[model samples]
Target: MARYVKISSLGPAPCVIEAGGSAEEAVERMIAHWKRMLGFVLPDKPDLIVMPEACDRPSKAHYPKEERLEYYRVRGNRIRDYFASVAAEHGCYIVYPTHMQAEDGSWRNTAQFIDRQGKLMGAYHKNHLVPAEYDANGILYGKDAPIFECDFGRVAAAICFDLNFDELRLQYVRAKPDLIVFPSMYHGALMQNYWAYSCRSHFVGAVAGLPSSVLNPLGETVAQSTNYYPYITATVNMDCAVLHIDENGRQFAAIKRKYGPKVKIHDPGLLGSVLISSEADDLSVRDIIAEYGLEPLDDYFNRSLAHRCAPGHMEP
Candidate 1:
Protein backbone atom coordinates (compact mmCIF):
# COMPACT_ATOMS: atom_id res chain seq x y z
CA MET A 1 0.00 0.00 0.00
CA ALA A 2 1.22 3.50 -0.70
CA ARG A 3 -0.13 4.85 2.65
CA TYR A 4 -0.28 8.10 0.78
CA VAL A 5 -3.37 10.37 0.85
CA LYS A 6 -4.43 12.65 -1.96
CA ILE A 7 -6.26 15.91 -1.22
CA SER A 8 -8.30 18.04 -3.60
CA SER A 9 -9.49 21.62 -3.15
CA LEU A 10 -11.99 23.65 -5.17
CA GLY A 11 -12.14 27.42 -5.48
CA PRO A 12 -15.78 28.36 -6.00
CA ALA A 13 -17.16 28.65 -9.47
CA PRO A 14 -20.62 29.30 -8.11
CA CYS A 15 -24.05 28.41 -9.45
CA VAL A 16 -26.42 31.07 -8.24
CA ILE A 17 -30.12 30.41 -7.76
CA GLU A 18 -32.05 33.45 -8.81
CA ALA A 19 -34.13 35.10 -6.13
CA GLY A 20 -37.75 33.88 -6.25
CA GLY A 21 -36.75 30.78 -8.15
CA SER A 22 -38.53 27.54 -7.20
CA ALA A 23 -36.78 25.62 -4.42
CA GLU A 24 -36.65 22.55 -6.69
CA GLU A 25 -34.74 24.57 -9.24
CA ALA A 26 -32.30 25.65 -6.56
CA VAL A 27 -31.74 22.03 -5.49
CA GLU A 28 -31.17 20.93 -9.05
CA ARG A 29 -28.69 23.71 -9.63
CA MET A 30 -26.80 22.99 -6.42
CA ILE A 31 -26.49 19.28 -7.21
CA ALA A 32 -25.30 19.90 -10.74
CA HIS A 33 -22.67 22.37 -9.63
CA TRP A 34 -21.30 20.05 -6.94
CA LYS A 35 -21.25 17.13 -9.38
CA ARG A 36 -19.41 19.18 -11.98
CA MET A 37 -16.74 20.29 -9.55
CA LEU A 38 -16.39 16.85 -8.01
CA GLY A 39 -16.29 15.16 -11.41
CA PHE A 40 -13.25 17.23 -12.27
CA VAL A 41 -11.48 15.49 -9.37
CA LEU A 42 -12.48 11.83 -10.13
CA PRO A 43 -9.72 11.50 -12.72
CA ASP A 44 -7.18 12.45 -10.07
CA LYS A 45 -8.72 10.02 -7.50
CA PRO A 46 -8.07 12.09 -4.41
CA ASP A 47 -8.75 10.54 -1.02
CA LEU A 48 -10.31 13.75 0.23
CA ILE A 49 -11.87 16.78 -1.41
CA VAL A 50 -12.89 20.19 -0.03
CA MET A 51 -15.19 22.84 -1.45
CA PRO A 52 -15.26 26.51 -0.48
CA GLU A 53 -17.75 27.96 1.98
CA ALA A 54 -21.21 28.53 0.58
CA CYS A 55 -20.28 27.01 -2.74
CA ASP A 56 -23.83 25.68 -2.96
CA ARG A 57 -25.28 29.17 -3.45
CA PRO A 58 -24.21 32.51 -4.78
CA SER A 59 -22.78 35.12 -2.44
CA LYS A 60 -25.22 37.51 -0.79
CA ALA A 61 -23.30 40.41 -2.26
CA HIS A 62 -26.43 41.29 -4.22
CA TYR A 63 -29.10 40.22 -1.74
CA PRO A 64 -30.54 42.60 0.80
CA LYS A 65 -29.23 41.85 4.28
CA GLU A 66 -32.57 40.71 5.69
CA GLU A 67 -33.33 38.25 2.88
CA ARG A 68 -29.86 36.77 3.00
CA LEU A 69 -30.20 36.16 6.72
CA GLU A 70 -33.39 34.14 6.21
CA TYR A 71 -32.24 32.24 3.15
CA TYR A 72 -30.37 29.39 4.75
CA ARG A 73 -32.89 28.71 7.49
CA VAL A 74 -35.34 27.51 4.89
CA ARG A 75 -32.97 25.74 2.49
CA GLY A 76 -29.99 24.56 4.50
CA ASN A 77 -31.01 20.93 4.75
CA ARG A 78 -31.66 20.59 1.05
CA ILE A 79 -28.29 22.01 0.14
CA ARG A 80 -26.54 19.82 2.67
CA ASP A 81 -28.27 16.69 1.38
CA TYR A 82 -27.18 17.41 -2.18
CA PHE A 83 -23.60 17.66 -1.02
CA ALA A 84 -23.88 14.52 1.09
CA SER A 85 -25.23 12.56 -1.89
CA VAL A 86 -22.28 13.60 -4.00
CA ALA A 87 -19.90 12.62 -1.23
CA ALA A 88 -21.51 9.17 -1.17
CA GLU A 89 -20.97 8.68 -4.87
CA HIS A 90 -17.35 9.76 -4.70
CA GLY A 91 -16.56 7.40 -1.80
CA CYS A 92 -14.02 9.80 -0.37
CA TYR A 93 -13.97 12.12 2.61
CA ILE A 94 -15.44 15.47 1.66
CA VAL A 95 -15.55 18.75 3.54
CA TYR A 96 -18.75 20.50 2.50
CA PRO A 97 -18.69 23.91 4.17
CA THR A 98 -21.95 25.81 4.27
CA HIS A 99 -24.64 27.43 6.37
CA MET A 100 -26.57 25.05 8.62
CA GLN A 101 -29.52 25.42 10.93
CA ALA A 102 -28.86 24.27 14.47
CA GLU A 103 -31.27 22.56 16.83
CA ASP A 104 -32.42 25.87 18.29
CA GLY A 105 -33.29 27.10 14.81
CA SER A 106 -30.20 29.26 14.90
CA TRP A 107 -28.12 29.36 11.74
CA ARG A 108 -24.44 28.44 11.96
CA ASN A 109 -21.44 28.52 9.68
CA THR A 110 -20.51 24.84 9.58
CA ALA A 111 -18.10 22.62 7.71
CA GLN A 112 -19.79 19.25 7.47
CA PHE A 113 -17.57 16.22 6.97
CA ILE A 114 -18.81 13.10 5.21
CA ASP A 115 -16.71 9.97 5.52
CA ARG A 116 -15.73 7.67 2.65
CA GLN A 117 -18.82 5.54 3.14
CA GLY A 118 -21.06 8.61 2.92
CA LYS A 119 -21.73 8.69 6.63
CA LEU A 120 -21.85 12.06 8.34
CA MET A 121 -18.67 11.99 10.39
CA GLY A 122 -19.76 15.21 12.13
CA ALA A 123 -19.89 18.91 11.59
CA TYR A 124 -17.42 21.51 12.82
CA HIS A 125 -19.26 24.74 13.43
CA LYS A 126 -17.40 27.96 12.88
CA ASN A 127 -16.29 29.00 16.36
CA HIS A 128 -15.35 32.50 15.32
CA LEU A 129 -17.87 34.07 13.02
CA VAL A 130 -17.20 37.22 11.07
CA PRO A 131 -19.17 40.34 12.01
CA ALA A 132 -21.48 40.00 9.07
CA GLU A 133 -22.22 36.39 9.99
CA TYR A 134 -23.56 37.68 13.29
CA ASP A 135 -25.04 41.06 12.37
CA ALA A 136 -26.39 40.23 8.95
CA ASN A 137 -27.21 36.54 9.18
CA GLY A 138 -27.80 36.52 12.93
CA ILE A 139 -25.59 33.43 13.01
CA LEU A 140 -24.85 31.99 16.39
CA TYR A 141 -21.25 31.16 17.27
CA GLY A 142 -20.01 27.66 18.03
CA LYS A 143 -18.38 26.83 21.36
CA ASP A 144 -16.42 23.64 20.79
CA ALA A 145 -13.39 22.77 18.62
CA PRO A 146 -13.84 19.17 17.50
CA ILE A 147 -11.18 16.94 15.90
CA PHE A 148 -12.43 13.87 14.09
CA GLU A 149 -10.46 10.65 13.83
CA CYS A 150 -9.91 9.13 10.38
CA ASP A 151 -8.23 6.11 8.83
CA PHE A 152 -5.31 8.03 7.29
CA GLY A 153 -5.01 10.42 10.23
CA ARG A 154 -6.95 12.69 12.54
CA VAL A 155 -8.75 15.46 10.66
CA ALA A 156 -9.85 18.91 11.85
CA ALA A 157 -11.65 21.89 10.38
CA ALA A 158 -11.88 25.71 10.68
CA ILE A 159 -14.21 28.07 8.90
CA CYS A 160 -13.43 31.26 6.95
CA PHE A 161 -13.26 34.00 9.55
CA ASP A 162 -12.29 31.44 12.20
CA LEU A 163 -8.77 31.61 10.78
CA ASN A 164 -8.38 35.18 12.03
CA PHE A 165 -8.70 34.33 15.74
CA ASP A 166 -6.10 32.72 17.96
CA GLU A 167 -8.72 30.75 19.85
CA LEU A 168 -9.11 28.17 17.08
CA ARG A 169 -5.42 28.30 16.21
CA LEU A 170 -4.39 27.48 19.79
CA GLN A 171 -6.91 24.68 19.94
CA TYR A 172 -5.46 23.16 16.79
CA VAL A 173 -1.96 23.50 18.21
CA ARG A 174 -3.00 21.50 21.22
CA ALA A 175 -5.02 18.91 19.30
CA LYS A 176 -2.36 18.56 16.59
CA PRO A 177 -4.36 16.84 13.89
CA ASP A 178 -2.58 15.57 10.77
CA LEU A 179 -4.75 17.65 8.47
CA ILE A 180 -6.92 20.79 8.65
CA VAL A 181 -9.58 21.53 6.06
CA PHE A 182 -10.22 25.26 5.90
CA PRO A 183 -13.15 26.55 3.89
CA SER A 184 -13.23 30.27 3.42
CA MET A 185 -14.75 33.11 1.47
CA TYR A 186 -11.68 35.24 2.05
CA HIS A 187 -8.21 34.27 0.87
CA GLY A 188 -5.55 34.48 3.59
CA ALA A 189 -2.55 32.66 2.21
CA LEU A 190 -0.19 33.93 4.87
CA MET A 191 -2.47 33.11 7.81
CA GLN A 192 -3.12 29.63 6.42
CA ASN A 193 0.61 29.06 6.22
CA TYR A 194 1.01 30.34 9.77
CA TRP A 195 -1.57 27.86 11.02
CA ALA A 196 0.06 24.96 9.13
CA TYR A 197 3.57 25.70 10.42
CA SER A 198 2.43 26.46 13.95
CA CYS A 199 0.42 23.24 14.25
CA ARG A 200 2.84 21.10 12.24
CA SER A 201 -0.04 19.91 10.05
CA HIS A 202 -0.95 19.83 6.39
CA PHE A 203 -3.60 22.42 5.40
CA VAL A 204 -5.92 22.49 2.42
CA GLY A 205 -7.85 25.68 1.76
CA ALA A 206 -10.98 25.94 -0.40
CA VAL A 207 -11.26 29.64 -1.11
CA ALA A 208 -14.15 31.24 -2.96
CA GLY A 209 -13.33 33.23 -6.07
CA LEU A 210 -9.59 32.74 -5.52
CA PRO A 211 -6.96 30.06 -5.76
CA SER A 212 -7.32 27.10 -3.40
CA SER A 213 -4.09 25.47 -2.27
CA VAL A 214 -2.65 22.51 -0.34
CA LEU A 215 0.13 23.47 2.06
CA ASN A 216 2.46 21.06 3.81
CA PRO A 217 3.60 21.16 7.44
CA LEU A 218 6.57 23.25 6.30
CA GLY A 219 4.17 25.93 4.98
CA GLU A 220 5.16 25.18 1.44
CA THR A 221 2.43 25.11 -1.21
CA VAL A 222 2.60 21.71 -2.78
CA ALA A 223 -0.45 22.15 -5.01
CA GLN A 224 -2.82 24.97 -5.97
CA SER A 225 -5.86 25.61 -8.16
CA THR A 226 -5.45 27.93 -11.13
CA ASN A 227 -7.73 30.61 -12.54
CA TYR A 228 -8.19 28.57 -15.67
CA TYR A 229 -9.56 25.71 -13.57
CA PRO A 230 -11.14 25.99 -10.14
CA TYR A 231 -9.69 22.86 -8.53
CA ILE A 232 -6.35 21.12 -7.79
CA THR A 233 -5.19 17.86 -6.27
CA ALA A 234 -2.01 16.64 -4.58
CA THR A 235 -0.92 13.38 -3.01
CA VAL A 236 0.60 13.57 0.47
CA ASN A 237 2.42 10.83 2.29
CA MET A 238 1.07 10.86 5.84
CA ASP A 239 3.79 8.48 7.01
CA CYS A 240 6.17 11.45 7.00
CA ALA A 241 8.02 13.16 9.83
CA VAL A 242 9.64 16.57 10.12
CA LEU A 243 13.20 16.93 11.40
CA HIS A 244 15.88 19.60 11.52
CA ILE A 245 17.81 19.20 8.29
CA ASP A 246 21.03 20.76 9.58
CA GLU A 247 21.18 18.45 12.59
CA ASN A 248 19.89 15.26 10.96
CA GLY A 249 21.32 15.45 7.44
CA ARG A 250 23.64 12.49 8.07
CA GLN A 251 20.95 10.43 9.75
CA PHE A 252 18.50 11.17 6.93
CA ALA A 253 21.00 10.05 4.33
CA ALA A 254 21.70 6.88 6.26
CA ILE A 255 17.97 6.11 6.46
CA LYS A 256 17.66 6.65 2.71
CA ARG A 257 20.61 4.40 2.05
CA LYS A 258 19.22 1.67 4.25
CA TYR A 259 15.57 1.93 3.27
CA GLY A 260 16.32 2.58 -0.41
CA PRO A 261 13.00 2.38 -2.25
CA LYS A 262 11.10 2.16 1.02
CA VAL A 263 11.44 5.88 1.82
CA LYS A 264 11.31 9.21 0.01
CA ILE A 265 12.73 12.55 1.16
CA HIS A 266 11.44 15.96 0.14
CA ASP A 267 13.76 18.81 1.04
CA PRO A 268 12.84 22.30 -0.09
CA GLY A 269 16.29 23.46 1.01
CA LEU A 270 14.94 26.78 2.25
CA LEU A 271 13.90 26.31 5.89
CA GLY A 272 16.53 23.94 7.28
CA SER A 273 13.71 21.42 7.15
CA VAL A 274 12.71 18.29 5.22
CA LEU A 275 9.63 16.05 4.97
CA ILE A 276 10.50 12.38 4.99
CA SER A 277 7.95 9.64 4.34
CA SER A 278 7.84 5.89 4.20
CA GLU A 279 6.97 4.19 0.94
CA ALA A 280 6.49 0.59 2.07
CA ASP A 281 3.16 -0.28 3.67
CA ASP A 282 4.67 -2.23 6.57
CA LEU A 283 7.11 0.49 7.60
CA SER A 284 6.85 4.19 8.47
CA VAL A 285 9.07 7.16 9.17
CA ARG A 286 8.45 6.51 12.86
CA ASP A 287 10.50 3.35 12.62
CA ILE A 288 13.36 5.22 11.03
CA ILE A 289 13.22 8.01 13.62
CA ALA A 290 13.23 5.49 16.45
CA GLU A 291 16.26 3.73 15.00
CA TYR A 292 18.29 6.86 14.27
CA GLY A 293 17.45 8.51 17.63
CA LEU A 294 16.43 11.62 15.68
CA GLU A 295 14.17 13.97 17.57
CA PRO A 296 11.41 16.09 16.10
CA LEU A 297 12.54 19.62 15.32
CA ASP A 298 10.22 21.06 17.95
CA ASP A 299 11.59 18.79 20.65
CA TYR A 300 15.11 19.56 19.52
CA PHE A 301 14.41 23.31 19.82
CA ASN A 302 12.87 22.89 23.26
CA ARG A 303 15.91 20.96 24.44
CA SER A 304 18.19 23.59 22.95
CA LEU A 305 16.31 26.33 24.82
CA ALA A 306 17.18 24.62 28.10
CA HIS A 307 20.87 25.00 27.21
CA ARG A 308 20.45 28.66 26.27
CA CYS A 309 22.70 30.88 28.37
CA ALA A 310 23.40 34.57 28.37
CA PRO A 311 26.15 35.54 25.92
CA GLY A 312 29.55 36.07 27.52
CA HIS A 313 30.38 39.67 28.50
CA MET A 314 33.45 39.75 26.21
CA GLU A 315 31.61 42.28 24.01
CA PRO A 316 29.65 43.78 26.86
Candidate 2:
Protein backbone atom coordinates (compact mmCIF):
# COMPACT_ATOMS: atom_id res chain seq x y z
CA MET A 1 0.00 0.00 0.00
CA ALA A 2 1.35 3.40 -0.90
CA ARG A 3 0.29 6.69 0.69
CA TYR A 4 1.15 9.29 -1.88
CA VAL A 5 2.63 12.60 -0.77
CA LYS A 6 4.26 15.42 -2.73
CA ILE A 7 7.60 16.79 -1.44
CA SER A 8 10.37 19.11 -2.59
CA SER A 9 14.04 19.66 -1.74
CA LEU A 10 16.14 22.80 -2.28
CA GLY A 11 19.88 22.17 -2.75
CA PRO A 12 21.29 25.63 -3.42
CA ALA A 13 24.40 26.85 -1.63
CA PRO A 14 23.18 28.26 1.65
CA CYS A 15 23.04 32.02 2.10
CA VAL A 16 26.30 33.87 2.35
CA ILE A 17 27.24 36.56 4.86
CA GLU A 18 27.69 40.17 3.83
CA ALA A 19 30.80 42.07 4.78
CA GLY A 20 30.71 44.38 7.85
CA GLY A 21 27.14 44.24 9.06
CA SER A 22 25.54 44.69 12.48
CA ALA A 23 23.60 41.74 13.87
CA GLU A 24 20.40 43.29 12.55
CA GLU A 25 21.87 43.81 9.11
CA ALA A 26 23.22 40.28 8.99
CA VAL A 27 19.86 38.85 9.95
CA GLU A 28 18.08 40.82 7.23
CA ARG A 29 20.58 39.64 4.67
CA MET A 30 19.94 36.06 5.66
CA ILE A 31 16.19 36.61 5.53
CA ALA A 32 16.46 38.12 2.06
CA HIS A 33 18.50 35.14 0.96
CA TRP A 34 15.85 32.76 2.23
CA LYS A 35 13.09 34.71 0.50
CA ARG A 36 14.97 34.55 -2.78
CA MET A 37 15.30 30.80 -2.52
CA LEU A 38 11.62 30.45 -1.67
CA GLY A 39 10.78 32.29 -4.88
CA PHE A 40 12.74 29.73 -6.88
CA VAL A 41 10.46 26.89 -5.71
CA LEU A 42 7.99 26.00 -8.44
CA PRO A 43 4.30 26.56 -7.83
CA ASP A 44 3.82 22.93 -8.92
CA LYS A 45 2.47 22.54 -5.36
CA PRO A 46 4.39 20.26 -3.04
CA ASP A 47 2.89 19.30 0.30
CA LEU A 48 6.20 20.03 2.00
CA ILE A 49 9.31 22.03 1.14
CA VAL A 50 12.66 21.13 2.75
CA MET A 51 15.40 23.74 2.52
CA PRO A 52 19.06 23.11 3.26
CA GLU A 53 20.43 23.00 6.80
CA ALA A 54 21.48 26.29 8.36
CA CYS A 55 19.36 28.05 5.80
CA ASP A 56 18.73 31.08 7.94
CA ARG A 57 22.44 31.75 7.90
CA PRO A 58 24.30 28.86 6.28
CA SER A 59 27.68 30.49 6.02
CA LYS A 60 29.65 32.99 8.08
CA ALA A 61 32.49 33.48 5.66
CA HIS A 62 32.61 37.22 6.11
CA TYR A 63 32.33 37.31 9.90
CA PRO A 64 34.57 35.91 12.58
CA LYS A 65 33.64 32.45 13.83
CA GLU A 66 33.17 33.88 17.31
CA GLU A 67 30.53 36.31 16.04
CA ARG A 68 28.35 33.84 14.15
CA LEU A 69 26.10 32.42 16.88
CA GLU A 70 25.24 35.75 18.46
CA TYR A 71 24.51 37.27 15.11
CA TYR A 72 22.08 34.43 14.29
CA ARG A 73 20.40 34.46 17.69
CA VAL A 74 19.63 38.19 17.49
CA ARG A 75 17.23 37.79 14.59
CA GLY A 76 16.24 34.14 14.72
CA ASN A 77 12.59 34.85 15.36
CA ARG A 78 12.36 37.08 12.29
CA ILE A 79 13.75 34.27 10.18
CA ARG A 80 11.18 31.93 11.72
CA ASP A 81 8.39 34.39 10.95
CA TYR A 82 9.40 34.76 7.32
CA PHE A 83 9.22 31.05 6.62
CA ALA A 84 6.01 30.63 8.60
CA SER A 85 4.39 33.33 6.51
CA VAL A 86 5.59 31.70 3.31
CA ALA A 87 4.25 28.32 4.41
CA ALA A 88 0.88 29.92 5.14
CA GLU A 89 0.74 31.73 1.83
CA HIS A 90 1.59 28.59 -0.06
CA GLY A 91 -0.49 26.30 2.18
CA CYS A 92 2.44 23.92 2.60
CA TYR A 93 4.67 22.64 5.37
CA ILE A 94 8.15 24.14 5.65
CA VAL A 95 11.19 22.67 7.36
CA TYR A 96 13.12 25.81 8.33
CA PRO A 97 16.60 24.96 9.59
CA THR A 98 18.63 27.53 11.50
CA HIS A 99 20.68 28.27 14.60
CA MET A 100 18.69 29.31 17.65
CA GLN A 101 18.95 29.31 21.41
CA ALA A 102 16.89 26.72 23.25
CA GLU A 103 15.09 27.31 26.56
CA ASP A 104 18.31 26.54 28.42
CA GLY A 105 20.00 29.45 26.62
CA SER A 106 22.25 27.13 24.64
CA TRP A 107 22.67 27.70 20.94
CA ARG A 108 21.63 24.66 18.92
CA ASN A 109 21.52 23.72 15.24
CA THR A 110 17.81 23.15 14.75
CA ALA A 111 15.15 22.53 12.14
CA GLN A 112 11.71 23.90 12.97
CA PHE A 113 8.52 22.62 11.37
CA ILE A 114 6.05 25.29 10.32
CA ASP A 115 2.56 24.01 9.56
CA ARG A 116 0.27 24.99 6.72
CA GLN A 117 -1.61 27.31 9.05
CA GLY A 118 1.61 29.18 9.82
CA LYS A 119 1.94 27.78 13.33
CA LEU A 120 5.08 26.33 14.78
CA MET A 121 4.68 22.57 15.05
CA GLY A 122 7.94 21.94 16.98
CA ALA A 123 11.65 21.79 16.49
CA TYR A 124 14.35 19.11 16.07
CA HIS A 125 17.78 20.05 17.39
CA LYS A 126 20.83 18.49 15.86
CA ASN A 127 21.59 15.45 18.03
CA HIS A 128 25.13 15.19 16.74
CA LEU A 129 27.29 18.31 16.58
CA VAL A 130 30.61 18.64 14.84
CA PRO A 131 33.74 19.65 16.72
CA ALA A 132 33.57 23.18 15.35
CA GLU A 133 29.92 23.47 16.41
CA TYR A 134 30.56 22.51 20.03
CA ASP A 135 34.24 22.99 20.82
CA ALA A 136 34.58 26.20 18.83
CA ASN A 137 31.17 27.82 18.48
CA GLY A 138 29.94 26.42 21.83
CA ILE A 139 26.72 25.03 20.36
CA LEU A 140 24.78 22.39 22.30
CA TYR A 141 24.09 18.86 21.11
CA GLY A 142 20.42 17.91 21.21
CA LYS A 143 19.33 15.48 23.93
CA ASP A 144 16.71 13.37 22.17
CA ALA A 145 15.58 12.29 18.72
CA PRO A 146 12.03 13.60 18.50
CA ILE A 147 9.35 12.85 15.87
CA PHE A 148 6.84 15.39 14.62
CA GLU A 149 3.31 14.46 13.57
CA CYS A 150 2.07 15.88 10.28
CA ASP A 151 -1.04 15.56 8.14
CA PHE A 152 0.85 13.46 5.62
CA GLY A 153 2.65 11.14 8.06
CA ARG A 154 5.09 10.93 10.99
CA VAL A 155 8.12 13.08 10.28
CA ALA A 156 11.59 13.35 11.82
CA ALA A 157 14.61 15.59 11.33
CA ALA A 158 18.38 15.03 11.08
CA ILE A 159 20.62 18.05 10.57
CA CYS A 160 24.07 18.19 8.94
CA PHE A 161 26.22 16.31 11.44
CA ASP A 162 23.45 14.07 12.75
CA LEU A 163 23.74 11.78 9.74
CA ASN A 164 27.17 10.51 10.81
CA PHE A 165 26.05 9.03 14.14
CA ASP A 166 24.51 5.56 14.52
CA GLU A 167 23.06 6.58 17.88
CA LEU A 168 20.54 8.88 16.22
CA ARG A 169 19.87 6.37 13.45
CA LEU A 170 19.06 3.57 15.93
CA GLN A 171 16.67 5.82 17.78
CA TYR A 172 14.88 6.63 14.51
CA VAL A 173 14.75 2.89 13.70
CA ARG A 174 12.98 2.25 16.99
CA ALA A 175 10.60 5.18 16.68
CA LYS A 176 10.02 4.74 12.91
CA PRO A 177 8.90 7.90 11.18
CA ASP A 178 7.06 7.71 7.87
CA LEU A 179 9.54 10.16 6.43
CA ILE A 180 12.94 11.56 7.45
CA VAL A 181 13.58 15.21 6.54
CA PHE A 182 17.33 15.68 6.38
CA PRO A 183 18.69 19.20 5.85
CA SER A 184 22.44 19.15 5.62
CA MET A 185 25.29 21.43 4.58
CA TYR A 186 27.52 18.42 4.21
CA HIS A 187 26.71 16.30 1.19
CA GLY A 188 26.59 12.73 2.51
CA ALA A 189 26.44 10.36 -0.45
CA LEU A 190 25.64 6.73 0.36
CA MET A 191 24.83 7.64 3.96
CA GLN A 192 21.49 9.09 2.86
CA ASN A 193 20.33 5.86 1.16
CA TYR A 194 21.70 3.76 4.02
CA TRP A 195 19.63 5.66 6.53
CA ALA A 196 16.50 5.45 4.38
CA TYR A 197 16.77 1.67 3.87
CA SER A 198 17.87 0.99 7.43
CA CYS A 199 14.92 2.89 8.90
CA ARG A 200 12.52 1.65 6.20
CA SER A 201 11.27 5.17 5.57
CA HIS A 202 11.33 7.72 2.77
CA PHE A 203 14.23 10.22 2.94
CA VAL A 204 14.54 13.77 1.61
CA GLY A 205 18.01 15.30 1.71
CA ALA A 206 18.31 19.04 1.06
CA VAL A 207 22.06 19.28 0.97
CA ALA A 208 23.78 22.60 0.48
CA GLY A 209 26.11 22.90 -2.50
CA LEU A 210 25.13 19.45 -3.76
CA PRO A 211 22.23 17.68 -5.38
CA SER A 212 19.32 17.09 -3.02
CA SER A 213 17.82 13.61 -3.25
CA VAL A 214 14.80 11.50 -2.34
CA LEU A 215 15.41 7.86 -1.46
CA ASN A 216 12.87 5.09 -0.97
CA PRO A 217 12.72 2.08 1.38
CA LEU A 218 14.72 -0.12 -0.99
CA GLY A 219 17.67 2.31 -0.91
CA GLU A 220 16.81 3.42 -4.43
CA THR A 221 17.16 7.03 -5.56
CA VAL A 222 13.64 7.89 -6.58
CA ALA A 223 14.34 11.54 -7.50
CA GLN A 224 17.10 14.08 -7.04
CA SER A 225 18.32 17.54 -7.98
CA THR A 226 20.66 18.11 -10.88
CA ASN A 227 23.71 20.27 -11.60
CA TYR A 228 21.64 22.75 -13.56
CA TYR A 229 18.40 22.59 -11.59
CA PRO A 230 19.80 22.52 -8.02
CA TYR A 231 16.40 21.47 -6.63
CA ILE A 232 13.87 18.66 -7.05
CA THR A 233 10.16 18.06 -6.63
CA ALA A 234 8.92 14.49 -6.14
CA THR A 235 5.75 12.61 -5.33
CA VAL A 236 6.10 9.69 -2.93
CA ASN A 237 3.52 7.13 -1.88
CA MET A 238 4.05 6.53 1.82
CA ASP A 239 1.12 4.16 2.27
CA CYS A 240 2.78 1.05 0.96
CA ALA A 241 3.53 -2.59 1.77
CA VAL A 242 6.76 -4.18 0.59
CA LEU A 243 6.20 -7.76 -0.55
CA HIS A 244 9.07 -10.18 -0.57
CA ILE A 245 9.46 -13.05 -2.97
CA ASP A 246 7.23 -15.95 -2.05
CA GLU A 247 3.91 -17.10 -3.49
CA ASN A 248 3.14 -13.43 -4.19
CA GLY A 249 4.60 -13.73 -7.69
CA ARG A 250 1.72 -15.92 -8.81
CA GLN A 251 -0.74 -13.26 -7.65
CA PHE A 252 1.13 -10.31 -9.22
CA ALA A 253 -0.17 -10.64 -12.76
CA ALA A 254 -3.62 -11.66 -11.57
CA ILE A 255 -3.87 -8.69 -9.23
CA LYS A 256 -2.64 -6.29 -11.91
CA ARG A 257 -5.13 -7.66 -14.34
CA LYS A 258 -8.01 -7.37 -11.89
CA TYR A 259 -7.33 -3.88 -10.62
CA GLY A 260 -5.82 -2.52 -13.85
CA PRO A 261 -4.40 0.98 -13.34
CA LYS A 262 -6.00 1.39 -9.94
CA VAL A 263 -3.26 -0.65 -8.29
CA LYS A 264 0.43 0.03 -8.87
CA ILE A 265 3.07 -2.67 -8.52
CA HIS A 266 6.66 -1.36 -8.50
CA ASP A 267 9.36 -3.97 -8.85
CA PRO A 268 12.70 -2.28 -8.05
CA GLY A 269 14.50 -5.03 -9.95
CA LEU A 270 16.18 -6.11 -6.72
CA LEU A 271 14.85 -9.68 -6.97
CA GLY A 272 12.42 -9.44 -4.01
CA SER A 273 11.78 -5.78 -3.25
CA VAL A 274 8.34 -5.31 -4.76
CA LEU A 275 6.39 -2.23 -3.68
CA ILE A 276 2.61 -1.96 -3.95
CA SER A 277 0.25 1.02 -3.92
CA SER A 278 -3.39 1.96 -4.57
CA GLU A 279 -4.55 4.94 -6.57
CA ALA A 280 -8.14 4.97 -5.29
CA ASP A 281 -8.52 7.33 -2.33
CA ASP A 282 -10.74 4.89 -0.44
CA LEU A 283 -8.71 1.77 -1.23
CA SER A 284 -5.70 0.65 0.84
CA VAL A 285 -3.03 -1.97 0.30
CA ARG A 286 -4.44 -4.11 3.11
CA ASP A 287 -7.80 -4.17 1.36
CA ILE A 288 -6.21 -5.36 -1.88
CA ILE A 289 -4.07 -7.98 -0.11
CA ALA A 290 -7.12 -9.36 1.70
CA GLU A 291 -9.27 -9.26 -1.42
CA TYR A 292 -6.80 -11.19 -3.56
CA GLY A 293 -5.38 -13.45 -0.85
CA LEU A 294 -1.94 -11.89 -1.11
CA GLU A 295 0.81 -12.10 1.50
CA PRO A 296 2.47 -8.93 2.71
CA LEU A 297 6.24 -9.17 2.76
CA ASP A 298 6.56 -8.41 6.47
CA ASP A 299 3.79 -10.82 7.46
CA TYR A 300 5.33 -13.52 5.33
CA PHE A 301 8.70 -13.15 7.08
CA ASN A 302 7.16 -12.94 10.54
CA ARG A 303 5.30 -16.22 9.95
CA SER A 304 8.64 -17.90 9.34
CA LEU A 305 9.57 -17.01 12.92
CA ALA A 306 7.53 -20.05 13.97
CA HIS A 307 10.25 -22.31 12.61
CA ARG A 308 13.45 -20.54 13.81
CA CYS A 309 15.10 -23.34 11.87
CA ALA A 310 16.67 -22.98 8.41
CA PRO A 311 20.10 -21.36 8.79
CA GLY A 312 23.58 -22.57 7.77
CA HIS A 313 22.02 -26.03 7.39
CA MET A 314 20.22 -24.99 4.17
CA GLU A 315 21.66 -25.88 0.76
CA PRO A 316 22.95 -23.09 -1.52
Give the winner by TM-score. 1
Clashes of 2: 6
Query: Please, what are the lDDT tens digits per residue for candidate 2 over residues 1-316?
Result: 4467889899888577765578888887878877777677747688899988877774666666656756866885888898889889889999988878767777888898999998999999898888888887678878877799999899989998788999999998778798999999897888998898778789999998898999887668999898897888899988776777578878888888888888888888855767787887778888988887888665676777744555754457
The local distance difference test score of model 1 is: 0.80
TM-score of each: 0.91, 0.90
**lDDT of each residue in 1-316, candidate 1, tens digit only:** 3467999899865665567655555567667777777788878877898989876655465444455445554565776676667667777888888776677878878888888887888888889887777897678889998898888899889888889999889999889899999998888869999998888899999998899999988888988888899899999877777788767887877887888989887887778878777889878788888888878877887777765644662344
lDDT against the true structure, per candidate, is 0.80, 0.83
RMSD of candidate 1 to the true fold?
Answer: 2.7
Candidate 1 weakest ten by summed lDDT: 61-70
Q: Over 4 Å off in model 2, which ranges?
A: 301-306, 309-316
